[model samples]
Target chain A: MPGKVVRVRRHSNFGWKERLYLPMIFVGLGVTARHFFENFWGYMIGKVKTFVVQYPEERLDYADAFRGHPVLVALESGAPKCVACGLCEFACPTDCITILPDETRSAIERIPKVFDIDMSRCMFCGLCEEACPEEAIVMSRDVELATYDREAMLFHKEDLLRTEEQLGRRIGFIREEYNRA
Target chain B: MSDLLQAIEEKLGDAVEDSHAYRGDDTILVSHDRVLEVMQTLKDDSSFRFNMLIDLTAVDYLGRDPRFEVVYHLGSVEVEARGSEPSSLRHRLRVKSGVAEVPCEIDSVTSIWPAANWMEREVFDFYGIRFKGHDDMRRILLYEEFQGHPLRKDYPKERRQPLIGPRN
Candidate 1:
């Protein structure tokens, strides 16, 4: 049996002058300079520059319908709006909401005595807010809810229930959504 | 039971307390105490060789009799070689970790299935369930200094004091 062998091809070698490598260096510099100039021009014209909000100093405005942390509402009569029907508790898939009943209020049925919401466990499905029959619970736009301690994440009734005065500018948007047909 | 599953059931008789087949997917509910034996037999037996352990986790059904149920989803990659159709097997072992302090020890399946290490760690991190023979059991998601398991049903929502200083 006969075996076949393949021969390799060799290109022409560069001279001493060509091997100095000044041409390659110039080509590399030209490519880098072109990139630098393009980026600089685009940035100067404000085309490539990003317009991200600085957050703490300059925050991005959230939409009127942006459901965030569920807040307990207070009635105009200076009482808690939550009737403690346990609907919110039942609606919560994670079972983060725990409501303890109070017998003081007659009209509101039961008020949350030790209402605790584990924020860490909350998937924020917005079911609790939607399940509220009395419109007592609403998700706040304030999303900066970072906590150092796990225990700190447990939000009680007092912490979740926002007073009318403390509603801030976000409340106006919420009110607009509430009033919308 | 499908022909393959029936063969498995026949091979591992009495080991499986109850088996559920839904939507062509088979889930065998094994007792917690015999989980190790069941897993060992499933791996060793030629008919139903469940070599791969997919995931392990715990569910806190607070109001139920068994407050905590550790769910283990096992898969058999070697089914194709044993003249059985290729299908993943899920085995959920319900460990009744009682309401207050349920002290029940289920043998670690990690000895046979090495992949159970991370899954068991995750279960421990979230539900506070301990795997007896686990080499390194520590919090995976939360910091080491972090208090109670957040996934537990009783984890509190609010803090006594505000996380930050009062608004200016």
Candidate 2:
């Protein structure tokens, strides 16, 4: 269907109501005034609830399924839980993840000597999290990752690492998802 | 053998190399040389008017002798409004033809259904399977300077190309 051309009708002539503009303008203003009055009255009575959070001052808790960005799960010892299997790297469609596996003296046998994720290239599709065999990589609620510097966006292994406690919600959600599947 | 497949086989005869109704999907394997003729017949045939070209793609079997197989999914819509007993029926058929590795080209169905234009281009882009008689054949997904067909089994997955255009 990609080759099919859909012709949408464009209205060049404005109707009398649109051309007059004053009546429609009043209608729009009436809508605004209605909302303002309703909100003001509700606020005065302290019965109205708001959808907006005070952003920086008050952070809204994201749901467990809300995928923000990929992060490496770290153990209590500060070492990454990842064994450098490279499944996540391979699963990444955008090739944003880069990993260099090295022999580790730990029982895991291997660890990523260098792991970098170019945030600019990362689409936050959570394919890396799904492909992780050890559940070492997961999507965290770290949505506010805007940076002024391009270099800052290229997150190193250290920058991507989050402790188990910090990622408890996501881990639980993943476990539940896998269990259901 | 489905009735549809039987009809197709009877209509096309020697052009149809093999056919099967594997699972529920009715598929007919046609000779690459006679693909355009087969497609035209399928589209124009009154009993099996496959008016819509649903999907067009190619598969690469690395070790296979032919190496590439272009697949086409054709769909037909039927409206049976006979004296208040109104009903609509739909039928689907899969057509596949093997293309040799040396001359990896197959006849384009674009002349019959214009929807095959970009799909043929995409097949050409990723699998390096050119569609014969396709106008303005160029890379659909990748850049023009892209070295190899990425979907080909022989193409290295991790192979990175030099940055083109400008580097910020």
Candidate 3:
């Protein structure tokens, strides 16, 4: 059976009320004013809570599960915890991690001479963190990683180091969640 | 053997080379030449109404006889009860057929199910396993200029290919 093709003209002409747009504008303003007054009264009486946080002044405390940027853990003696195994580099799907292992005179014989992570290409999948046997490389809570230059985004070993105290919550969470010692 | 595999075996005796049910999965290794016939029967037969072709892909087993195995996942919606409100049940079947390394070809199931069109193209793209009688058999995922099948076991994972097009 042949199908019917109905030809119809597009309605381009607008109604008088739509063309004026005065009622719609006032309606939008009314909605905004209602919200403002409700929030104002609620704030004055301390009955309701506001969710808006002043950026740069007030920051949200991220959860332990929050995966932001990958960083290397540093011990209290000012030495990296990494053994330069290159497991994180291998686990990285984007090939954003680069490491150069060299022999060290420290307790851990092996250490990464040069470790670089390209933040621009990082997807923050946390596969590297899971693959780390020594728990050296971990996902930090540092979300504000914006930079002007591409070279600045390539974080070296020194720049990627974070003290154990700073990453205690995340380490504890990972150990507890993953059932690791 | 599961009921599905036994039924398929009884229906297409000679066509089914081997069949097994492992970990609640019904897998049947069909003869490469008669795969299309077996697939058609599975779809048409009332006992096993596999109306949906869930996925079609290929696995390259290097250092093995019949180097490639084309896998097809078929799903069927079965009426569980005969009551007024018929509850539907889902059954899945895995169909595998081995293809030789030298020729590396298999009859396309596109005629039985149209969804096999792009899927066969993808298998051909990744494993270089050509689907015979498939019209417009071209690369689906990778570009035409791609050197070799990247998914093959022998293909180096870290081997970097020269960048295509002009770069500043």
Candidate 4:
């Protein structure tokens, strides 16, 4: 006995009715008109209920759990709390993180001399945040990361460091989740 | 093992061997020479119409006689009531002829089922297993210029291939 052969033929009908798509066109126009008139009427009545907003001037409120870019946690002492363990670099599935451990540490035992994250390669998976032993690296809600050059997309340690004030919403969200758990 | 193994053995005597059921899964280990025949029989036979090829992969056992084991998961579309849910009877099969590491070769099953082409290519790409009758036998996962089989046990972990950008 042999394996059975499966034959599947596709039947597509492109008749005259399909060519004259006036009915479908009218149906689509009707839906658009209904939306336009409803939105216009709502605006005239001072309802202030429209789907589209004036972008660049206003933005929707994002959830606290939103994952965007990874940022270094800055301590109250004006120093980043990262221990330069290179765990984030190792744990990065896309290999976007690069942490060069500080060889010359006068007071601190270990810190990153050069911490680089190529934003182009990053998938925003939040694996680095999970890999952080000291909670030094966490995901930020700053998703507006457009740049003119590729070199600008490669964030350095200085650019990535964010104070507790900057990450207040996310820190509180994470703390609340931990407390609940 | 659902009487299917015994029926398969009766149909293709020496081709099927070391078949047993574990955790409700019926797994059969077959010799490499008659693997294509065994797969065809399993698919065409009315009693065991395992038409769907779920997956095909190869496992490298370092410091072993065969060095590599090819795994094939087959499923039949015939649905039957099992408790409250309907389920297909899927069978897992493993085959090995114990070839040397120099040129790991096995007869391709693409003649029976065309779905094995890409799968065989992937196995060849990762484990360096050569399928004799495969029409297009190229690296499916890795670049053509990739130095060595990454999944092989002997392949080094830290061996660096310097490129324009950083390592993946």
Q: After superposition, how far is residue B4 of candidate 3 from its true place, in Å?
A: 2.2
Worst 10 residues of 2 chain A by lDDT: A1-10
- Top-down lDDT ranking: 2, 3, 4, 1
Report how closely model 4 matches the true complex, as a DockQ value: 0.08
The model with the greatest lDDT is 2
A best-first ranking of the candidates according to their DockQ comes to 4, 2, 1, 3
Candidate 2 has a DockQ of: 0.06
Query: Whole-model lDDT, candidate 1?
Result: 0.71
lDDT, candidate 3, A26-103, per-residue tens: 988999898988888898999655668788898878776999899999978777889889999999999999999999
The lowest-lDDT stretch of 10 consecutive residues in candidate 4 chain A is A1-10
Each prediction's total of clashing residue pairs, residues at least 3 apart in sequence or on different chains, is 7, 0, 0, 0
> Model 4's CAPRI class?
incorrect
Write the residue-wise lDDT of candidate 4 on A2-119 in tens digits.
Answer: 3444545764776676678987788899999998999899999999668888987988888878998999998887677888988899999999999888754546577788889999
User: What DockQ do the predictions score, one after another?
Assistant: 0.05, 0.06, 0.03, 0.08
Residue-wise C-alpha lDDT for candidate 1, range A1-181, written one tens digit per residue: 4334344576468776568899878988999898888878878998854456566998777766777878787877766788778899999989999988787736656777778889999887889876777777777766778989999999987788777666555456555655646
Q: Which CAPRI tier for candidate 3?
A: incorrect
Question: How many angstroms is residue B126 displaced in model 4 relative to the true structure, after the best TM-score fit?
Answer: 4.0
Candidate 2 ranges with C-alpha deviation above 4 Å: A1-28, A43-54, A68-139, A148-181, B79-89, B166-168
Cα lDDT, model 2, residue B114: 96
lDDT of 4 at B34: 75
Cα distance off (Å), candidate 2, residue A149:
4.5
